[model samples]
Target: MSRKPSNIVYAAADKVPLGTLISLGVQHASLALLFVVYPLVAATEAGLSFEDTQILITSCVIFMGLATILECWPRFGSGLLLVQIPNTSHLPLAVQSLAAGGPALYAVMSLIAALSQLSLTFFTGALRKLFPPEVCGVAVTMLGVALAEPALRRMFGLADQGGAAMDLRYPMVSFAALVVIVVLAIFSRGPLRLFAVAIGTGVGWGLAHYVGLTHGPTGRALADLPLIDLPQLGWPGLAFSWAMLPAAILTGVISAVDMISTVVSMQRMDDADWHRADMNQAARAIRPNTVADMGAAVTGGFASASSSAAIGVAFATGTTAWRVGVVSGVIVVLAAFSPRLIAALSVIPDPVVGAILVYSSAFLVVAGMELILSRRLSDRRIFTVGLAVMAGLAVAILPELVDATPDWAHPILGSPLSVSTGVAIALNLLFRIGIRQEASVPVTTDDNPFEATTTFLEHQGDIWGARRDVISSAIPVVAEAAEMLLDTGVAEDGVVLRARFDENDLDVTLLYRGAPIEIPTLRPSPEDLLGDAAAVARFVGYMLSKRADRLLLGRLGERQTLTLRFEH
Candidate 1:
């Protein structure tokens, strides 16, 4: 039977109402715009004139908008409703480039990173093997953790922004905004639920204005802005540095990892019967971002990648319609030419931004947990997940480690997603050693052969990192075969069970000193089954034939063998 995506109001290709699309676009554009602060900080740190800063910010906004549209194109993007934005992970590298060589240098570095990501498209088919669900989970978990800390700090008025005085209203307004969003998303139906995030942010912004949170310099900044403006291209760096190459290339790799994980998450959201990662589709999805990022480089913008938070937040609306992404992308592009609109978004109170981020973070953290637990875990896998998670948190939770790291290492140290994913890949590879594809064990009638067979293969499946669905389907067939061998007295003394597993197939063989179970090509008659024990064995063979992909009756020297093969 065909499977339709559940909990979805509108799927990717659905036609959304014009009004709903416009509203959803505004909400998404606003969310994507929040990351503008990263580049704003970079421009501020670079000490550029107000004009130069606008140019830089405008370039980023333009490319981000373009990226959003391209990411929905099947040839270029994951063909899902993924919002693209200025990457927060690239902040350290952006700051470094802007300081050392200006926008031109940063543009060149970004181009290099984009090229690196483009090169990765060739190997997307192998990415799933390299980053299994558990590994992707580690990366995603850290991505969420990375988002939560700064957001909570700002929301609670704990972060020192220019040593400003702490405000009690920050928590009050932010928490209220959060509750509003949560309640609407969880309890409301139809359009109310669809616009939950947009409504919450609007309420939060209104409260911020009413409470005077934006009445200070923030208000002044927006008030002074013109209604509309044209963008100027930022400088091309006259200087160059080989020292930055490692970080730039690593940036590309990080972007690929982020893109792949986001694509996987989207695939799961789009398919109710999802059981495994589809690397081919993941490759197709990431191609457009790499292309968009290349455009970003020449335009003097930071490299762009998929926003996992945007995916999580929008999913709450139950409409991942590709049309929304297209409309949202167009809105972002149009907003780039409007100085006042950008200014208004830029001045959103820190606490409100925190509330929205906190809302998005819940989805990310939970998705990561689900991906990690999607497969069964053995002792080795448990340690791999545990240690990798702790490694990511160590970087995210501890201030001292980031401080102790030299400035050159700051880019890596600042990105928990990168650190955790790198650790997960390394540890996963290291743990793969010494695990044999083939295993053997003795079986007898004394114990519950069914339970023993179940326990044995389940353990092996975990360590082998086999597909959960394949492992699940194989279990009952093998267990039932084992029970039949002992119960039917085909093997009076006992049986020797041997199993072999690989990426493509699972083969289980029972060797015993007895007559072979018949490999029946057709169903036996009920009257034939009533005649003798042989007829019953034939009936058992017919049932096993239907259960397994393939069955063989043969001999292993002096003993008979029953072979069951499952396509993995």
Candidate 2:
């Protein structure tokens, strides 16, 4: 049986009931709060005063809200439901910069990095060739793998790197939280499943309190926080330092890669017809992200990027509406000014935070694996991805190896993410030196049917031994069918047209999710063609039947496949 597509609301432009929107908004806000750990860890590591830490946190939250709004904006954003937050991958580098030259220098480094990302947006098309799926995928997977140690450290009460003994109770509490989260994620349904992280955190916090294991700020301390305090605004004291440049550049590149992957993931979750990312759209998405990072730096916050955790929440809740993201951003902005709320959140048990990190990090790892495995894994791809992952894991597991590197190269080689990304990109490019590139292009509604179809046919002609005349003739036929699909609104986003060339025939399959389309063989009468919308449909059907040698439509689950075969 072909299961019907779910009527779940999706996309930035899609509308949902007000009540549901509000609920989803709150869910997104809760999930986004997990990012607070980034700035908190940075501040603590930098040995900043309580007041200074509060300022940094405030700036981070406010700018994150502003960024999320920009990311959801129709003109500027990727026009997808994306939530922006501090980039965890940059945390170690951020700490290093902060330690090297105070908050001002750190801010300057972040600013430079943001500018670099902004510059890269201009060359996104070119960069895509270098940073293909395998490279990006390995880097992304390594990011998750790298995060596992920190998560474990927090879970086991060994977060203080200065040889703090593990607290026996920490693992018990974190494990309980992990179990709760895993159970809820696997067994719960709908909104409850989306709240697994929040719920699990609460459960862990309760257990820690009951067991007298809560170690951070007490509730009494939070109560002392003032109800309202205006945010201190000023340009981060800028200091030019050559030592920071390498880290800045590496951070910018990593941020761009993360943004691309995150945006693609969000789009896939929101749109059923999204087969592959629209690189142009991904480039557009990076512009506002760089702007946000610059904004954060100016306001005394660390570097920021899109939040995968929030995207995971959206996927879980089936809430991809831009309005929900807007509301969530508003909530964060409001929370920023509330000192008590900030203080309370700051006091969340470390074990609970660790549990949440574990939960979210799992998603990042899976997303990365999916991206790498999206194509057939030939030996070349396997080697490219395997080497990258192994290299990244080596760096992540062995801190001493990074320390052994020269000081100047530390910023680039110290982080597992940087190492993995570099290795994957280098290896992928090296392996492709003599190999012929495949003729494949991602399709979206914004693409021109005539151009895409003609390119596909021309490329396949050489491989299939089809005559130029036959291949040329099939272009219009394919283009018209694609036009028909788009014009009739049969696919929500667009279809992926994949061409397979065999010895006897060249087959082009259009993969999309929609109702089964009926192709008409007989030409429509003049009166019928001149009538209504059905007339247009009949015309498309008649055209397809006349031009195609064979047309086959099949449905598996919700996906509808249209295959056109032309005898070579």
Candidate 3:
């Protein structure tokens, strides 16, 4: 029943060892902690004092932990190893809200985002078709692509403020860290593989420490912080503004898209026979993540989004046990109470974090490509994927384009993952205008049976946007039956091959005024085949049965029908 890839050491449902669970949890929690900088930057923009800023950061961590735990439950969450972290996509908006009306307006935006996302749950089924595998694949790929600049910047020793020259030592440390991660993830096995991310990060941290690369304000006063204390609460009263609603809604939608892409990628990684996305599951996945946004609303925390990078780390480590996610969530909550611990994680050498992101990004990008190519690509689909990719890259590639967009457009046009996926979904819906889901061809005795059948199916397959392997597999079933109907001389005029398609099934039904083609359950032996024409025909039926997923022989009023079904 488990069709997960061979490389999967522990799947989402598998019970894990306590030690491995804790180890992996610590790894993911460490990665999640690095993202605190997003909120830290937002706080700086808000002009809050040091104490209030620390309070905001703690609130983000508290909810991040709670959301992670909630995410492990199928009723409330994605039931995958999708970690919730501060939404970098919303950072611009967060800054705007903070500047416009202080933390109160920011909290309102977070609440708006929560409601916007909550509304999407009802339409999960509809959203699936609108955002096909290619569109979702583009989103998934960009999730990794977006990580490149920050990863590289940190890897090259970019400063906290800006415009810092790349340090040679930074790359040296990053290179060492990346090698450790890659070697352990790709070449090692057992516990070594399971703990690859943590091990590599530890190695990187140690080297950075030795080389005096762990340079940050937090490290300077690490000894002064308490080992454990209650995280201070700085409640920013919520107040909604009409001006902020559109932007907040946009952030919610973008965050939802991010969740969908990450969940789809996780579904792909978990199953070997991933045909299409399970959107019901995807919707459920989004539920817990959106709820995390609601967590931000009450706690005065920054808005959270699904972390594809965190999942990348899981995939790289060859395990995605839910237990690890649960315990890691707990660890994050505990870490929030320890300022020294936060301080320790805060100063965890930028290059090392960069190295981890770089390693994980490579996995996500390639995995996304596999998802995009999972189905057959028509010219229409090719354009859809290609154009969407360019649009997303445009955000990262051209800063002026983003800067020129109006304030309302920031949530959509500002982020590569957001703009790219939005374009793909829109274009996908537009291109679906002329494509017919059904097609038929009338076979005449004068026409070559193979040529007519193939041309019709192939053409329709492209227009219908069918899966490549699926349509190819279906071609022969229709061809063989068409040839049989014509050669047997049982048709009144000729025969009509009709093909119908939906997301789950590709059905081809042949209509002819003749006896139904006999579907033999048993394979014909050589003696049986040589005996008579009937046996040879029966053998042909048997052969076709093997090719098609399902075969049906029946009559519809005046016509005897033979239908072949291919599971899409």
Candidate 4:
């Protein structure tokens, strides 16, 4: 008899359970509302008429949909099935860029951003090593850190002036919405929890409407809109500013990183790894975003990308497939087609969006924090890494402190996600290699650092050395072992230790004393099995828990290798 198809295969075939897809649809609708609301507000500030704003907003949603689709389905079998939405990263810079060079300049910059993103995608493998989870966690942390001010500003009711006169600033609306979302997410079981953001926004909207706070758009504003028109798309006429390059590059790089990170994180969430995933199929996932985003930027629309929020929808409902994503995209497309509907949704107060944003941003930060802390690092190493992260956050928030510095320095320094990560990596390397202790002394028991050395030595004489076996079984443990050996002088002699993981198992090299070693041992251990479930529940939950450390911690952290040579 044929075996029943597994859920994994079903998910890959785009067979998400219907209830889950609908729930995600609501989220896409709310996100689409923001696409209109925020962009219109920004465009109004840029001196565009209501009609122009409508044209731009409509065009942008379409652009976003295109990007979303491309990211999900690749024409050439290589897409990253990640959701891309209008990048919040560009909001601050877009305002500045618009203020300095008009919408035209911003559009020109969009082209540059797209070009850069495409280039990065083409060379993603090379860039992959540069952005490990630690680095990505830092970048994501900084993104939210930079966004805090804008969120606060929206929380304070700065964005609304004349259109859709709802005072989103009302504490009742904001706080009520926030409470609803929080309570639902924390307590509500199953699909209800997934709709927390959407429910909160809707509740806030209804409350605002009941309070007689908002008036429907009338007269001049109503007449100003074009019922149906093709979105304008072309190369922007704005002059290229050299100073703008860095900003564009920053935006582009962050966008690409965000897409890749979200994809990887989602896969982990779905218990899907790179090997199991159809790389060609996965790469095709982001094709929609590329086309839509590029078109949106050229047509005076703000760029958007997909959300990893799909992972939440999938995890909550126990489904993982492009169908959910496609459903979300379809909702966005439907909303985009109806300008009136778009306008009505766009009328949602900043506080509502602000409240949702605050929650989402906080969630993002928590995720980042969890990712950073999940890794096994020494206490001193953690502190060093933590300092870099905080420094980057501070730089992002109080940029004026570095006002004397060039604009180019801001992206590099203020971004805790990048700079601190770079620092943390450097520090990790230094701590592992620079620290020193007795070479011959081995830590035989788990009681002290020397115990690790003793343990390694105890197994060294066996046909299958512990280091070799353990290293082959788990790559991360190699770092732990090498640090121990290098510190104790065992690895200093530059010997290649060999060990068999099991009887008749092929011998494998687990570590190289002096160089970055690549030991290809692919097998799942108990920790690996547990790690998948834990990372999905909360990227850092079980990984960082003190209890998990005993089993998770490798033998290498405390062990040492003694290299002795005498004339033959």
lDDT of 3 at 381: 88
- 2 or 4, greater by lDDT: 2
Question: Candidate 4 deviates by what RMSD?
Answer: 11.6
Q: Which stretch of 10 consecutive residues in model 4 shows the poorest summed lDDT? A: 559-568
User: By TM-score, how accurate is candidate 3?
Assistant: 0.94
State candidate 1's TM-score: 0.90
Q: Taking the candidates one at a time, how many backbone clashes does each contain? A: 6, 0, 0, 48
Ten-residue region with minimum lDDT total, candidate 2: 1-10
List candidate 1 segments past 4 Å from native. Answer: 1-5, 159-165, 215-229, 234-238, 445-447, 466-473, 486-496, 502-528, 531-534, 548-568
TM-score list, all predictions? 0.90, 0.74, 0.94, 0.66
lDDT of 2 by residue, 1-568 (tens): 1121252334567786777677777767766765787888898898877766766777888888888877777687777788877787577667887777777888888888888778877886677666666665776676667667777787888887468667778889999998887887667776566566667778998999998877655667767877777775556688768877887887787788778767766655565544345667777778887787788787787667887666555644555678888888887788787777766666677787777667667767887887676544556778888998888888777878989988766766667777888888888778766554324455678999889888776755543324455577678888887877776777667877877753246677777776567666677777865666556766776767667888888875677888887765
**Global fold similarity of model 2 (TM-score):** 0.74
Q: What is the lDDT of candidate 1?
A: 0.79
Given candidate 2, what's the lDDT at residue 375?
43
What's the lDDT for candidate 2? 0.72
Point to the candidate with the largest TM-score: 3
